[model samples]
Target: MYAYDTITEAVSDLKKRGYTKDFNIRENRLACDQLDTHFGHEDFEIIEVYRFEGPSDPADEAIVYAIEAPSGALGILVNGYGMYADENNSEFLQQLHERVRLKS
Candidate 1:
């Protein structure tokens, strides 16, 4: 429920507050490259989401997610909002299509 002006600021503050996991988009799930672990939707829950838009270009659209795993692991997922994230050919991403919709 917090408003962040930039992705970097949101990420930095969230990490400081314990959302420390760095989750990368994988073909079918989220991966913590540092921990050598893969997380399915069932393994974690979305705690908060932040959406941002460019003052001019549409390409600047993005979203940030605060997430927590059942095992007490925490993380963030920074994703694009425009065609970049839309064209991802991943089943897991497709499943989240409705939930992460961005407003123009």
Candidate 2:
């Protein structure tokens, strides 16, 4: 794992490494607006996870996920954690994380 000072820096470096597409949690799946496609938890893999916590504000807590689909699609998902996180999104990500852990 790479060390990053901020979420912006992490995202920038990831994009440079080809994680371009941006993904959002859409119910139980990941949605890429640029591709107008939705992917199930089993459809993609989380390559890396970068977490950032605010020095002052708890709401600033965020997580960046480097994801890759089976079809060779690479993307990133930026989601909030802690108190500001969405319930369904958190649960969905948890499922993906479990899958990755099992594979490991």
Question: In order, how many clashes per candidate?
Answer: 0, 0
Report the poorest 10 consecutive residues by lDDT, candidate 2: 95-104
Candidate 2 similarity to native, TM-score = 0.87
Candidate lDDT values, in order: 0.78, 0.87
Best by lDDT: 2
Give me the runs in candidate 1 sitting further than 4 Å from their true place. 97-104
Candidate 1's TM-score: 0.82
lDDT tens per residue, model 2, 1-104: 89999999999999999999999998878999888899988888889888899999998899898999777889999888888988867778788768757866
The digit string of per-residue lDDT tens for model 1 on 1-104 reads: 78889888999999999999898777678888767888775577788888889898878788888887777788898888676675553567665554445311
Residue 38 local lDDT, model 2:
93
Model 2 RMSD, rounded to 1 decimal: 1.8
Tell me the lDDT of candidate 2.
0.87
For candidate 1, what is the lDDT? 0.78
